[model samples]
Every structure is written in C-alpha cells, then in structure tokens.
Target: MASPGKLDTRGSDFARLARQITDAGLLDRRPFYYAIRMTIMAAVYLGGWALFIWLGDSWLQLLVAVALAVVFAQLGFLAHDLGHRQVFRTRRPSDIAGLIIGNLGIGLGWGWWTTKHNRHHANPNHEDHDPDVSPAVIVWSEDQVARSNGLPRFVAKYQAYWFFPLLTLEAWHLHIASVKALFKPEAKRRGPELTMLVTHFVLYFGLVFTILPVGKALLFLIVHQGLFGIYLGSTFAPNHKGMPILTAEDKLDFLRKQVLTSRNVRGGLFTDVALGQLNYQIEHHLFPNMPAPNLRRAQPIVERYCAEIGVDYLQTGLVESYGQALRHLHEVGAALRRPLPIQGA
Candidate 1:
C-alpha cells in the first residue's frame, strides 16, 4: 500500500500530464478530419452495397461480402470515435452521430455499446470492474477459471487456441448483446435504438435475400458477419488483453491505473488507419477524448512523461502484441490443464 503522501503525489501525476497534453492541443476536436473521414466512409459504404447489387447472383458476390465486412468494421471504428466524443465537443452531437453510424450504419446499439465501452475505459484491465476482462465465453484469470463451469470451464483449458476462431462469432455476440441491452429497465433511448436496429436488419437482410438466391444470401451473411467479427476483435485484442489484471485491492491513481495496464503497438500511418488509431493504447487510455488523428502526435509526449515518472512504458510490434495477448490467455488456462492429483498413491 502506498503512503498517504505518495498517494497524493500519484493523484496529481495525471493532472500534470493532462496539462501538457492540453497545451499541445492534442485534446482539441478535429472537425475537418472527421468530416473528410465520414464522407469517405459513407461513399465506400454505399459503393459496397451498389457493387453487391450489380454483381447479383454471382458467387463473386462473396468477394463483395468480404469488402463490406471491412466497411462494417470501419464503421464500427467511427462509432467508437463518436462514443469517445473525439469528433464532437458535446454529448448530443456525439450521441446522434453514434446512433446513426453505430445503429443505422452497422446494426450496433449506440447507447448500449457506449455504456459498456465507457466502463472499459474507466477501468481497463480491472478484473472486477472492466467488462472487457470479465468472464464470459473466455476467462481472463485463474480465479475466473476456478469459478467457471459448463461451457466456459469446458473451453478454459484451450481458450488460447480457441480465441481467434471464437472471434468469428463476436459480431453475432455483439448484435445479440445490443438487443438484449435495450430490454434492460434502465436503458436510455430504447425505442429509437430498437427501431434503428430493426430497420438496419430489415434493410440489410431484405437486400441480400431479394438480390441473391437464398443459398447465396445465407453464405454471404456468414462470410460478412464472420469477417467483421474477426477484424473488430483483432483490432481490440491487442490493446489490453495480456496487460496486468488488477483486483479491487490494487489501489492506484488514474495515471498509473490506465498507463501500467495498457500496451501500445508500434506502427506507421497504415497501421494507424487500420487499427482506428487505437495502436496508441496507452495514450488512448490516458486521454480517452483525444481525437484519433492527434494520438500519433501525443505519443512521444506521453512516452517521455512516463519515463520521467519512472513508469515502465510498453510498446511492441503489431505481431508481437497479439502474441503477448495469446500467450497470456494460454498461461491463464494452465491450471486447468494440469493433471488431477492421484489419491492414495
């Protein structure tokens, strides 16, 4: 446990860093960048469906499915930015855009996802508080393994190997979770969210079934949804999956809590664009509202400050980040893999 004096110092650490970041204008919203980005995404989205229709009944439509999957994942990324308020200064505009992009554009529930995601940002890697690390189809820690039963227990011993394959269903999981969230008593804007979700599915399926034969439509749905899941899951898995998992006893200031448990992936512009600029996980965690385009500029300032404060900063190559996360998954399941002790040997 830290002394009271040390705790107070730690509390101010983030404030100092935040001041530096604000002075650099890194936290300012980039309306122009967002405008250009949203326009381009909209064009690509409409173009994708247009291509689908033009290629009607052809198996090459499978290729169109792949393209649209990428577009959907990209829309998901845009919605993420909206939820973070990176594109807008106020919650109203952000929420509105998030609803359009998340619900109407990609069949995700904006309110539900933002609520879940905000919790994740608030408590990244926290075993108890962060829903991202909570026990579900996959368990993140050994304690979760001990508490597990049924399907979760059945898969715990091999979760590392199952992780990527299971991501093929992540999109479906998200869609189901989104709909279920709307039924909760405290869900906000439930009527609008449900309406948009219904409209999205109706239009999405209606086009597919009407344009392609039933068999092709089914195949197209499977491919598109599967690829979208994999892409979105892969982008996020590298952020904090293998990082330190904190318990309730781990009392740290916001700076250390967010920084110590996040890992950054090293890359250039292409990686930045592909990962939706989330490659700067530490910076993103440190300043959740920072515009996506400004993260790259903020990286060096953050890295220097962390070093001056004697915090260990983690950054790895893209491939290595995934390897680290998968390795952690393997280690968490190790207890389950050990042979049962023989009685009365």
Candidate 2:
C-alpha cells in the first residue's frame, strides 16, 4: 500500500486560519506570563505538599502525594515555556523559575531546550530532522495506530510497547554529537548541563537526608517519580506518533501543520483538569503561546478550519488514545532494529 499523504491547505481558506492565529497576538511579555504561570504552579505544589504532609502514613497519603506529583508535571510544561522564554516578559526570571520548577520533574535547561525544542517546533514530523517527531522507527499512520472503538476494546487490548521507555529516555542521552544533535551543540558541554538537573536532585536527597527520614524520602522519590512519570508520559505520545510522518516532499507552513501534525486527545472533564488540558493537543500546538486555559475557546474555531481545508484532524477519547499510544510503543519495539528516518538530513 502507498503511504498516506498530506492535505492541501495553501489556497485562500488557510489564509483565514493564519489570520485568526495572528489576531490572537503574542503576549505582550512572555516573562509576565511565566511569572503568573509559576505562581500558580507554586501554589499547586505547595498546597499538595501540605496535604501530603498532613496525610502521613495512611494510604491516603499516597493519593495526596500522587496528586502533587501530577501537578509537578503540569508545572513542568509551563517551565518548558520559560525555558523557551515564551512564558515570561523577560528571560532572567523565566530561567530562574523554570530552573526551579523543572527540578521537581526533568530539569531541562533554557539554553538546551531553546536549542532543541525550537527545532522540534520548526521541523515537526520531519523524519530525520524533527527531533520532536518520530524518526519513522515505527511505521504506522494515525488511523492505523489508534484504537478503532469502545472502552473494552482498548483496556482489554494493548497496542504500543515503546512509548514509556522512549518518553523516559527522550532526554536520556541529551544531545549527542551527530547530524541531528549538532543543532543543539551546546549540549556537548557537561558542566552547565548537569547544573540544570541540580534542583530536583537536591530536593530528592535533601528531603531524604534532612527534611524527613531517609526511608520516607527515598520512598517518596520512587512513588512520586513513577506516578509523575506516568502522568506526563502518557498524555503526550498520541499527539505526534501515528500521525503521518513528514517527508521532504511535504512543504508545510506553520498554519497548515498546526492543523496537520497535532491530534486532539478525547477525554472527560477531570482528564482535562489533571492532564493540563492536553486532550486538546492540536489547538495547543497551533497556538502554543496562548495560555492553555484559552484553548477551550479556540477548539471550535480550529475544528472548523480543519473541516474547511480537508485536513484529517484526529480526536479520540484519551481513554482510548492512551491504549493507542501503548500499542504504538509496542509496534516500535517490534521494529527496534530498523533505522529511524531523520528529517532534513
């Protein structure tokens, strides 16, 4: 069978989608946005931490701690913006705060992420070049990769085998020198790179040695990181994987891909609240600068644009999409020996 191709959105119609995004306007100051974003995360983190401390050894403590850890992941996403200087009015505060919040989670540095994440956005879905998208390591288009129907159908079945490990390892090696990692060459320096990971490592050990008993702190890291890992990892994969991989033949402008490359995760309201509203992945990618809170308002307009242009906009109740992601992982694992396609190289 032939590979599924892309949509044609270049004519007069997409001109309108482009205009709407432009009219949304850039935030006057991304740092100001970071300030507000960090404040909320701090509140969420501190509040959750207090609740966990109060819960003590009861099993409920685990639940509370788990909730706080999930918030930790959401805050990580905001800090991602700070790293890009997209969240703040100025770069300095964005870096300091992003450095702090990200410690609790992954601890990606501003200089490093600016080097890589921007490339991800600019070249999304290109097999060799777009680090953010798949390397074609696993071969399946969006529809082939996702579940067909019903809750029992998904929960009872598992499809992907690669997502969790990939999510865990994505930043594992950092930027290794190669045709790809060269885009973020600064990563070759180890000293500053390790400095960024210090905050969380300090917290984990500091809690273990000083704030709490060593046993308790160690347990907290294990349970918290595991739950937090699941929370962050699962929500993200379905957006890019399984979507048609982009090739050199494809010429995508930002607006076209804002529609093309992203998938909307389907889920209930609580899913929205917990996962940082990521179920609306397409809208988020399209207007990444817009506060995530606003994507609810943007969803309809984006949906309308996709329909008008004949783009295959994907939406799945995440309950199902989650399984789809797992299935994709398995598919990739099955093809582990194959060389991944590198975009633009």
Candidate 3:
C-alpha cells in the first residue's frame, strides 16, 4: 500500500465520521474517571516509595523499585492522556498534570513529549517525519537500514531478535534524551519543566544512594530502569510497529492513513488499564482528543464503520502483535545484507 501522508481528507467518510464522533460528545472529558484513576495510581506510586524507603538495603527493595518504575510509567501515560486534553476540559489544568507526572514523576519533559507525540499523531509511522520511527539503534525500514553504518548497521542486521533485550536500555535513553532536550540553550524558556526533571533525578538518586550501598544501588537502578523501559515500549510498540511505514511523499486520507497504520490489541479490562486504554490504538488515533475510557465505547462504532467501507482494521493478541512487529524488523533488516551501491560510479 502507498503512504497516506498527503491524501485528500475533505471528501473522505472519515471526515464525516469524525464529525459524528465529535457531535456525539465522545471528545468530551471524563473528569471523574481520570480523577479516580489518577488518585489510585498516585497512591500506588507513593506506597511503593514508602516501602522502598522503609525497607532500606534488602532484596525486597529491588521489588519496590521495580514496582515504582511501573507506576511511574503509568503516571507518564496519564500525563500523555492529559496532554491530549482527554481528562481536562481546558489546557491549563492539563498542562499542570502533565508537568507533575511527566517532568517530576518520569523525568521526561512535558513539552518535549507533547511536541514529539503531536508530530507522531499527525503522521504516525512516517519514516521521515515520525520521531518514534526515526532510526536509532533499530532500523524499522529497508531505506533506513541501507544508510546505517558501524554499530547501528551491525545491530540493524539482527534488530528483530534484539528488539526486546535492547529496550532494557530505553529507560536510560529517555532520561538522557530528556535532559539533553531540556538543557539545550534553545530550551531555556522551559526552565520550570527542566527544573522538575532535575529535581526528580536529584531526589531519586539521593534516596537510592542514602538507603543502599553502591553495588546494590547500581543494581536497583538497573532493574528499575530496565523494567520501566520494557513496560513503556510494550505499550507503544504494538500500536504501530508492525504496520505500514509512511513516507513524506505518500498521499493518504486521514481516516485511511490512521486505520491502516494503527493496530488494536485484543484483550479484556485488565489489558485496557495496563495499556492505558491504548490497546484501542485505532480509536485513539482517530480521535486524539477523546478520553481514554471512551475509546472502548467508541470501538464498536469505529469498527463497524470500517467494515461497511471495507477498510482493514487490524486487531490481534498481544503475543501475535509482538511477533508481527519483530517480523517487520527482520524484513527491514534484509537491506543491511545487500551490497551497497557504488557512489560516483
């Protein structure tokens, strides 16, 4: 299929469906649900911190740290939902929530996430435009593999197999990236966000170092960061990793583009909470501003609409989705084995 980057969206039924969804108030905030959910997450996070502090130097401390990391990632998801104005009606409160959860809790810059995420939503799976898909240690497309070199090239050759193991470093990657982005001269105006991120690290490291010996602290940090990375990546990868990769030149309508490129993970309520309602990725992409809780309710409507129009709506189990995403990486990695074209031939 062609990339849907520049397609005409004016006449598409997706346009009409979007209007209907909006008119039906699906885009409205679900303050009560968010309030309760956030409260529960916050309590769990705080409880974990309390236990970690009280336990001091023990193997159980590592468990508490891992639990804290998971809770922190979920808080990040809440911040993401707030960024989309899913819980709050206005932007100010949402921004505040984003600051607290993203900067303070996760040590991620809210503005950085919002800017990058909005771009991804605007052009998800676009090889050139989506930061999420932009080549780093792992190349997701054949074109990217051809241009990669050195360590990256070596990794791309076996990226599908290495994907999960490599994610163990992603938590560290995010912290470093967030720090770099926030501390840049161009980002000085975002001092408040930067300050919160700094504060989070200071307190986080201080508590760890104070309670545990150097060796245990290091191990605790690694375990916390590793599990955190896996949790975050698992939530996001299944949404679009195995789907189509769009380029800047591809012309696709908004509806067709989002539906074709996004996949929904099939599961029950447990999966919904675990994935932060992102298991309904197609619904979330179609209505970016919709409350997370509402996505489940909107699923049947969106699915039926796609069916009537013969649009393929992708949905699969968690295991299959991960396998599919890995298969895609291997397929792209094939380009790395091909001989490079001679330049200036």
Candidate 4:
C-alpha cells in the first residue's frame, strides 16, 4: 500500500504537467472557432428540416433523416463542449448555450447531462462511481454480471454482438433518462429544462406529422432517432470502453487515473470533425475546460510528458479502437457465457 506522502507526491505529477500545459497557452479559449462552427451547424440543422419539408410524402426523406441524425449528433457534441465550459468561461453562458443546443435543439436536458458527465470526468472508469460503466442493459464487469438479473443477465452473454443493435435505442434511453432526472429531488433547472424538452417534442412531432403521412412520419422518426443514437454512441464508445476499469481498491493518481482509463483514436481532419475532437480523449479528460480546437495542439505535449513519466499512453486507429472496445465487452461477459454444470455433476 502506498503511504499518504507517496500519494501526495504522485498527485503532484498532474500539477507539474498542468503547469506545462498552461504555459503553452493551450488552455486559451477559441471563441472564433466556436462561432464559425456553431454557425455551420445551425445552418445544416435548419437546412435539413427545410429539405424534409420540401420532399413531401416521399421515401427520399429517409435520406434526410440520416443526414439530420448526423447533424443532431454534432449538436450533441456542441452541447458537450458547452457543458464542460470549454466554449464559455462562466457557468451562466455555458448553461444557456448548453440548454439551447441540448434541450431545445436536440431534446436532451442540459442540466441532467452536465451533472452526469461531470461525474464521468471525475471518475472515468470507476466501477462504483462511473454511471457509464454501471450495470444496465449491459454489464461492464464481472461483479456487475453477478448482480445483474433478468434482461441484463440475458443480454450479458451476447453483449458484444448486441452492442451496436442496442445503440439504436440509445437516443430514446437518453431522452427518457433526461426526463426522469428532472423529477429527481436534486435536479436543477427542472422547470426550464422540462419546458424546453416539451417544446422540442411538440415542434419536432408536429412538423413531422404535419409534413408527411402518418406511416412516413413514423418511419422518419425511427430512422432519425435510431441513426442519431448510433452516431452518438459510436462517438463515445471508443474513449474508455476498452481501457482499464478502476475500483475502490485502485488508488491511482489523477494523471494516471485519467490517462490509463482513456484511449485516443488516431485520424486526420475528418475523424476530428466527426468525433467532435473527442478522439483526443486523454487530453480532453486532463483539460476539460480547454477549447475543442486546442485539444489537437495539446495532444503531443501531453503524450511527451506522459512518456517522460513512463505512463503508457494508448492511441489506435478508429476501427481498431471500436474492435478493442467490443473485445473488452466480450471478455467481461465471459463468465456468463460458460456452460452451466449438471445438477449432480
């Protein structure tokens, strides 16, 4: 066991790296970048809906649904940046923008998501602390496999195969979770969030139903929401899924905790744009407030510093990262997949 003094020294490792990062001006805000990005995203979003309205009572609208799903996921990425205060210095402006991009634009509750995401950043892959890894329709660890029953248990044995299929419902899960979070006693901005969510639903469904026949309208909803969920889930799945899973017993320093549990996906401009720069998961975790544009600049500095300190930094190609995550999911479910022994044997 490490002594308290040793732990303090280990913790200071992050502070030293933080100082280097601060000195590099990588932490500075990029207002112009955000301004341009938001403009483009807004244009794409509105244009998608306009195209939908233009193509009345046609199956070609499904293509528009696919396009809008990508736009919605992009909006979700913007909301994530806003929630992290990467776009705005103060909580007020950040929350305001977050609510618009998240609640009003994408039908996600900004407050609920921020609270949950903050917790995720604080403890990335901790079994007991990270809600992302908590037992749900899929179990992340053997301990969770033991505790899981009913749907979770049934799914655990084939979770890797089920992963992508289940992601189809991720958008609906998030929407339901957002609403449920509002009813919790500790929920903040409940009234405003509820209003925006309701308004979003009304505007969204009204426009769809008003523009198309009932069958087409329902199909549009399915394609749009399903692809939205898949895009969003795929964006997030690579970050930490295959990385180390921490527990109460693992007392890692801040630097190691974040780096060890996160994986980076390597790509050029297209990947950066698609993943909303979250492909640089390690840098993002280290400097949550750093603007999205600055993450690329900060990456090499972080990687070099980690190398200097002998902390293993993991980066892989986009497809490989997904493969690793799926393999991890399969490995976690190994126990559940074993054949049961006969009663007498």
Tens digits of per-residue lDDT, candidate 4, 26-86, equal: 9889999999999999999999989988998899999999999999999999999998889
Order of the predicted models by lDDT, top scorer first: 4, 1, 3, 2
Off by over 4 Å in 2: 1-15, 24-37, 47-64, 83-86, 103-106, 133-159, 162-196, 211-216, 267-269, 330-345
lDDT of 3: 0.87
Q: Answer with 2 or 4, whichever has the higher lDDT.
A: 4
How far in Å is the alpha carbon of 25 misplaced in model 2? 6.5
Off by over 4 Å in 3: 1-11, 185-189, 337-345
- Sequence-dependent TM-score of model 2: 0.69
Query: What TM-score, computed on C-alpha atoms, does each candidate reach?
Result: 0.96, 0.69, 0.92, 0.96
In model 1, where do residues sit more than 4 Å from their true spots?
A: 1-11
Considering summed lDDT, which 10 consecutive residues are worst modelled in model 2?
Answer: 173-182
- Name the regions of candidate 4 deviating beyond 4 angstroms: 1-11
The positional error of residue 10 in candidate 2, measured at the CA in angstroms, is 10
Task: Look at candidate 3 and tell me the lDDT of residue 296.
Answer: 90
Model-by-model lDDT, in order?
0.92, 0.59, 0.87, 0.92
* Tens-digit per-residue lDDT, 1-345, candidate 3: 324443334566787677767777888788788889988988898888889888988988888878887897898789889889888878888888888888898788887888789999999999988999888788888888878888778999889889999888988888888878876677743778878998999999999999999999999999998999999998999999979999878899889889999999999999998998899999999998899988998898888778766689999999999999999999888866678899998
lDDT of 2 by residue, 1-345 (tens): 112244334555456675665576532344454467667877877787677666555555556657766786787677655654555656677656655655334444545555566677776677656765532233343332243235322322233544454444333333121123324544543454455466555654564345446566566656666666666667666677656567778887776765677778766678776667767778777766665666666777778767766667788876667666566545544433347799898
Greater lDDT among 1 and 2 belongs to: 1
